[model samples]
Target: MLYAAINAKDHAVYTLSTVHSWRISLSISPPSPLPPSQMTQEQYILASQPNPLQRTGCAQAYPVGIYGWRKRCLYFFILLLLVTMIVNLALTIWILKVMNFTVDGMGNLRVTKEGIRLEGVSEFLLPLYVKEIQSRRDSPLIMQSDRNVTVNARNNIGQLTGQLTVGSEMVEAQCQRFEVRSSDGERVLFSADEQEISIGTEKLKVTGNEGVVFEHSVETSHVRAEPFQDLKLESPTRTLTLEAPKGVEVSAGVGEFKASCRKDLTLESTEGDIFLNANTIRLGNLPHGTTDPLLAPGTTYAKQTVYEVCVCPSGKLYLSPAESASTCQTTNSVCLWS
Candidate 1:
């Protein structure tokens, strides 16, 4: 090997001696880091790059990421909610449509024709108005319904004004007069204006007048009158009369009342007053001191002394067993005792 030194301008003017060796060695140093300002554009871009796996795996979900599953769950939940809301809205609309109703001037919804259907009325969502409401058939306008019929109204005021018949009984009613006729030729007449009611039968004719008002509830069954009036009752053959306080008036038809009260009794007529007469009789409890039975034969105990009673035959009253004497003597002994 030879070593030489020379000047660029004068290569022959500057020269160096050379030495030759048997072995030649060369050393390589590690490369230096390039300064940020001095680095090439490619090097700078590569050095500042984000992780490639992070970017790619997020864009296309890998097994480790839950992005895809969460999206699917969100969509399914939204769809289920939408379906449920739609169904609820449909049901609400149907219920509202079925319940729609209105009332007429007579406070009635006259559905006389057959095959007519109504819904939601039992729910009472719509207003109801009438005096008394009942579903009835026998009129040409209304067909007989085997199905359970329901009538919704405030009261049956309008329906009671016309004639109605059930079985052999005929009912004639108006704003004031109410009549009921039986199959056995019995008839009952009631009037609103006059405090009088009449029930006609083959064996007996019961008549109630204004005086009967105070002794009976105006709403007494089989009889009719203003609810506020007083009542009194009388039997001409028995020559008996009965009276009660203002609200204690009661009427039980036929001989039914005989079982509840005795044949001859006198009680306070009104709250503060007491009226008594020779033939006027009030009722006591059952003859045996037992409660009145629901029903009994007319002459159930005519032969027995089931009750303790005072007798006033023509006002000469006496106390005796029914079997001992059929009549109370009008003798001086009995009268003097009284």
Candidate 2:
């Protein structure tokens, strides 16, 4: 029985050893250090991670990765700022273009690619020539002056801006409000009321007030007043002076006429006619129309010259004969041969 037991124990021990050997043979072996190609998925992933320069999107969970993320954020912010700046600049340029579209320094007035445009003004005054005046709609320019108002519609559009009142006796151009426009050395003037306006190519003059008058003539381009009155005139030739009495006579030949004083006036001309109108008349020297030694009241009766003179209704006068010193005191005194 003891030997059997011993044999059984030995048998069991052998069986256990054989089973252990079998299990050992079936078990998986511990893996060797990975080779370059045989590395695990985790190891491969770690190795394939990009370098700092090549990295994109999120970095790995490391201090270096955190620094890279901050740098990326900074770059993104800078890019965003650049985009915003570009957008703002575009908007500003657009706004400025829109604001200055209608007006321009070169075209002081309204102008288009097709032609120039002039707005109708109530009044205007100009000292230069007008090269061109383009008007829109049916607005007119009312001009008043003592000088002649010239309308040069040679190449004008006939836009009929307004009418011109020249050499007006009522309103004066000197103290009036007016507007003017000029381009390329050309000027245009406009006014609303009557005015003593002088308009010509070279010069322009205006006269105001009751005694204000203008004289335009082709023969003797002269302007004169009786006394105590303002006269403005422009002519192509010389100036002439004539004197007359209030109730005597008044005359005009041609051209424009103006009177400032009143006196018995007699106007007679051999070649041309005379112009006489209502005006103030001052008792002045008879012949020369100026204060002179010979024209005093108590002077001797020297000689009679042909000149139109003004005498009061019953004023006393001494007429002397040219041959001798004989004086006559008759109303109808004439050299009679009796």
Candidate 3:
């Protein structure tokens, strides 16, 4: 690099050569700055420069404050910044006036004297969970839908306990069992399940405005029926007794009437006679309880064979074998119970 060394007293100039990396120090040979008297103002300024050989035109000429085009650029930048700040402040005021912002509310929802009012439709992307929802005016909460509405009761584990679905034409419920309870919640008015259905408070009475009807047979603990069809009653393991307060009647006018038993059958009447009214009476194989038999007039043996039924005069019965079976006809000798 080349630098000019000027002698102020003679106005002579000298050219000095040095490398760019070395410091620009005229007093480097002696390690002391030059005395102020022999140095002119220009030479003193030239020697005091730390980078005298590298000149960047006006920057090196006037080194303190911004000057010339750079000064103009700094002023223009300050003006532009002020204008930008003014424009931003104006826009901010305009937006505040247009939007009418408030600190107490958010967005379009505003708090008024009556209640809170939301301007647009509020859509929830996720499930809205709330404990209780009610009207502010203490009225019933009215929710209307075009098609169906459903309500579900869930446990803490998110398992559904019950579900009530109401459609346009029908309403359905899903649960294990269903019961209609009384107003006081004491008794069940109606209950239903897969097994049985019960009604009333102990007794069930049908008003039968259209008459009670049974399409098929009904079997319960005490009463049973086959409706208007044929019905039969049988005892499988125990004895069956038919009793009534007044009388028990069994009528088979057009059909045959027959009765048989696996064991012995006894018919006893305490106040009335057991009348057998038929055109003909038939008897099967039987034995009679008797001790004496007729002597056949010649023999005197009491060995009775084929003892027949005989009626006494007192209407009491005792078996006797005369010449033939007789109700009360006694020709030779009459035997009566003693």
Candidate 4:
């Protein structure tokens, strides 16, 4: 049998004979190409050695297919980085624009170099501390409180011009009292309690469209009116009483006075004099006959005879003639002499 072998070191081919058990060396021939499975160690080592010209920092060159896949992955990463940067920049710009619009678009509000200006209904929920509050307009400004509102200024003053109306609503004040006082805290100019309103100053004048009514009694120390005017007391269907602990006096200057009662009139003097004065004196409704004999002194006549009489200044009674008796007595408080 003939067998061939290759030298691992020199890559030389050799022939061998196994029947005689002898090895024969042939003439050196160039090694033939072998399959990868049959490749010598020298050939494997030569194939595995890197090419000096192509050698770099990386160990070896990649295959063509894998190199293409690496290129595609690099491109995808760069594109992803650019898209992320653009999205971040756009988001930042949009956020800044939204903030600018919100700060500038407030109605009736301005931010200037001098200060801030607030117009129209401006309300504050938090506590606002300021030096002063003032109104520049000439029209009336109203401040109202639903419950109670207090204004405290320690080192400043509050001033109001024109008419001030307090508690104008029909509802009363919650505190039930309103007062105006001077700086000294002693004098009260005006005050109102629950039932009474008082003005403590010099003069008070009240004019009501209807009539002023005093529900209870009215008492004063003194009352005086100027000039001559009629003081009238009227009660349509009720009793009007005037009572005094001391005494009541009425004086009319140079005016004629009269008193009349529709029912009955009485003149009573408890402890003083009742004086009736006029230019002339008259009496009526006297009894025709005197019951006492002393009242008709020295006069004797029949029962049917009537007499007209008069009382003279000398304290004597005189009788008229019989014809004038009926006529003189019929006239009102007049004595007709015949």
Best by TM-score: 4
lDDT of 1 by residue, 205-254 (tens): 33544243233333332344345543344453454433343444455443
TM-score of model 2 vs. true structure: 0.21
- Model 2 — which ten-residue stretch has the worst lDDT? 9-18
Decide which is better by TM-score, 2 or 3: 3
Pairs clashing within candidate 3:
none
Q: What C-alpha lDDT values do all the predictions have?
A: 0.42, 0.42, 0.59, 0.54
* Window of ten residues with lowest summed lDDT in model 4: 329-338
**Model 1, which residues run further than 4 Å from truth?**
1-70, 82-128, 131-188, 192-338
- Pairs that collide in candidate 4 are none
Which should have the higher lDDT, number 2 or number 4?
A: 4
Error of 4 at 262 (Å): 4.8
Order of models, best lDDT first: 3, 4, 2, 1
List model 2 lDDT by residue over 52-84, tens digit each: 333244322222123468879988999999999
| Candidate 3 steric clashes | 0
